[model samples]
Target: MSIRAAYIEKMKLQLDELNTTMDELQSKAGTTKIELQEKYLKEMASLREQSQGALDRLDELKTSGEDSWKSMVMETEKVRDAFVKSFHYFKSQL
Candidate 1:
């Protein structure tokens, strides 16, 4: 397969893994005190938005041509990085 196809596949898997991590974190968050749970929920909402943005970028990347796919890859990486960073920060708070 072409490098572009390979890169897209890797990103899709990364996003899937990120979703699973979020689910696990949410499960842990559920047992926190009500006050902290509210805060974690707000942060999780932001993480969800970032995850959705990454998914949206992935969809665009899938449809892009060879010439445009490189740029899409860069853009998608930015979104994915932000999501991962946010998740790490949230996890640290727990």
Candidate 2:
């Protein structure tokens, strides 16, 4: 497979993992105190937005030609890293 294809596959896997983590987080939130639940919900909503942005970036990368794919990869990485960090922070709070 070409480098672009491999990169796209890796990104898809990352996104899947992030989604799973998010689901777990949501499940844990159910047991949180009612007052805190509102805060957690807002944070989770932001994380979901970040995840969607990464997916959108991946879609762009898939259609981009060789020269432009690299840039998209960089932007996607930023979004992915931010989401991961936010997930960890939320988990820590619980």
Candidate 3:
């Protein structure tokens, strides 16, 4: 695959990992007992850290290229904006 394709694939993998971490944190928030809540809180914090690390890696990859990386950055920005719009729309409905 081309360098741009490789970068995009890697980014998708990182985003998937971050999504999993978010799911875990959301699941933990639904628990009722105090002990379970604490457990979830700890797990959520750990997952949050992991997700942040993945995001940092993504940023590093995104900026590391000289030519094709520009396209990747532009496309990624467009997708990010779409995601934000979708999120905002959903939030408004809630």
Colliding pairs, model 2:
none
**lDDT of each candidate versus the true structure:** 0.89, 0.86, 0.58
For residues 8-89, write the lDDT of model 2, one tens digit per residue.
Answer: 8998998899899889879988898999999999999998998898888889888988788778788888988888888788
Candidate 1 structure, TM-score to reference: 0.93
* Deviation (Å) of 26 in candidate 2: 0.6
Give the better candidate number (1 or 3) by TM-score.
Answer: 1
lDDT for position 67 in model 3: 63
Q: How well does candidate 1 score on lDDT at residue 7?
A: 88
Which candidate tops TM-score?
A: 1
Which stretches of candidate 3 lie above 4 Å from their native place? Answer: 13-21, 24-28, 66-94
Per-residue lDDT for 20 in model 2?
96
lDDT of 3 by residue, 1-94 (tens): 9866686686777567556646754674666578766765675565556455556555755566676667657656555444445434433432
TM-scores for candidates 1 onward, in order: 0.93, 0.90, 0.50
**Per-residue error (Å), model 1, residue 4:** 1.3
RMSD of each: 1.0, 1.2, 10.2
